[model samples]
Target: MPIKTPDAANPCVFISAEDVGKVGTETPQELAGDLGFLSNMEMIRQAGSFRMGVTPDIAAAKQMQSVPKVAIVAAPTDAKIQSGKVLLGTDVDLVVRMISMQQPHRAVPITGALCLAIACRIDGTIPARLARATLNTLTLSQPSGTIAVDANVRYINNTPVALSGTVLRTARLLFSGLVHH
Candidate 1:
């Protein structure tokens, strides 16, 4: 199922662990600071490979040129969420991190949050494996804080085929003036 943001701009498709190469890889004893970033890059590369009908080796050098060159990953249990606004409680089922094509790859965008929440409900996805069974709400532990999303999953033939998710995020306009470049 594809997850689209409220603006209908960013569309995300969930990929399986096998596709992302997380199936046979050993779970790291400790998640290095850049582990998620590296993983996300790899996922992006893999997606690019699939899109271009090539191997990851060739895609690694050219993945950055691909459209929608970004990826998000669900953080494992060991990784900690560094945020002062919200305390990390036991209810945190998933932690989402965004990796983009630009610098400062790590981020916690609202769209990514919604996508992660929806992905959690889908079976066989990385987020689904880590997510706890919930009726509708999912608390995604991001770097900034936790985002709560209301999601509904529709099943077909015992498989998730569609998802509807909504999240309320507080956005403040820091600066709104036109700038001369």
Candidate 2:
């Protein structure tokens, strides 16, 4: 499922319940840090099983005048990490949250960033075409970072990388013999 493009000031990403339950993720701090300037240590928040936080930016302001940023990134854990499989059950509903740091005057779509992350994770490559599609469809500017093909393990309510694939394989195998002609 595609993520919705949030308003300029308060951008967020939302996926279907099914997708959220299937992907396994790393600790919120690790994902945040890996995202470079988007994560901050002090803004981290733990609510029930979900983790919420903000990113701090001193350099971004000096660098770009037209980017929507949140001094924080938040992730809610929808599944537990076990044998590289994130169970697709109702117990967990993972969602990634980010706030807009850009001045209200400048309209920047922050949810595009989250959408890009999800697209890259599912395809293992962020094609320029796809990025372009996202920009066009979401009505947002193209972000800076290039989507390099790398080994990514997004925990919690992030992307469904290799671990999610592994889990899917297992499920298919389990049903393989049962659904016979």
Candidate 3:
């Protein structure tokens, strides 16, 4: 039986088998490139936002029985410099949890980087019209894409926007001979 809501009626978003198939094939490939490189990058792209690899073992946290579960975590680092006049850019982190399990922890990096980059582009602003134009020229958007959520806070007299978010990509189901539909 189909489920129904009290006020509205239909679901917020609907994903057909075809839509799911397209998402499966195109999303990760376009976003992360090869899995090996992506994994390493996600692990290394330091700055808080990238969280694709390791997360808390929630099941373990929830359990009164067994050991419960495990998790994967990533730690990244980088170096940047502001020469001439000092410029402080807002620091943001976007995170995505692609998969989860119990026992141990792990994560993929390239996907995390791409996901964070897209999110930063979406919410960050430019100093001027010219600067914004240049940034648009240099930015790239992820295709199909991973699911990411943002956590933002303003700091230092609103001079910098500190943000953190998570992204997710789910495995697709195979049906019959076709990819999905």
Candidate 4:
């Protein structure tokens, strides 16, 4: 099941699966592209409006709808700019445990992860990758692609505090020109 983060800034949802193939089905690949459905406000609206407890048919999380959990499922580097182009999907499938979706990216969003990072501290929250006592990074797989979120969560007085959440991304030169200031 996917849990919608309570965050209002950069809303996101987290879920778990058995493998990557099952992860991509959230959109069912009918309308979205090979990159999968775009994770943006559209997804947020769709999920927010979902009936939640009641819905005999139709999945609230479209791409994820009715897809049986089979399997589950990122990285980047620093540079002012780089040559590599961002691609959709990965060559290797994952035996992943948890996944996330954030706006402007079908993949994982660092901002989204921040919300989850804090949520993880809550008492009732199900720990992502429960097998591990500590989770330093979170791998999120979606229809379009996947990515890893770098999380630095600190604890104070048994309360979880979010220090930082980041993602490394390759940069492409979008424009290079001189401007008269």
Best by TM-score: 1
State in Å the error of residue 147, model 3: 6.8
Off by over 4 Å in 2: 1-93, 102-181
Against the true structure, what is each candidate's TM-score? Answer: 0.57, 0.21, 0.21, 0.39
- After aligning candidate 3 to the native by TM-score, how far in Å is the CA of 84 from where it should be? 44
Shift of residue 124 alpha carbon in model 3, Å: 6.9
Q: Which of the two, 2 or 4, has more TM-score?
A: 4
Residue-wise lDDT of candidate 2 within 72-172, one digit each (tens)? 21123333332444433232222222223322112113343444344334443322222222212221111111111222335456634333111111123
lDDT of 3 by residue, 111-136 (tens): 43333333244334211111122232
Q: In model 2, what are the clashing residue pairs, if there are any? A: 25-154, 25-155, 25-156, 26-155, 54-71, 54-72, 55-71, 55-72, 69-101
Candidate 1 is scored at a TM of 0.57
Query: Pairs clashing in candidate 1?
Result: none
Q: What lDDT does candidate 3 reach at residue 162? A: 36
- Residue 159 shift from truth in candidate 4, angstroms: 1.4
lDDT agreement with native, every candidate: 0.51, 0.28, 0.25, 0.37
Cα lDDT tens digits for candidate 1, 1-181: 1232231124344444344454211222222234674556656655654454443354453543432434434443433444334434465666554444433223456665666666677777666875666775777655555678766677888967545668866689898787799
Give the higher-lDDT candidate: 1 or 3.
1
C-alpha lDDT of residue 10 in model 4? 53
- The local lDDT score (0 to 100) that residue 115 gets in candidate 4 is 52
Model number with the top lDDT: 1
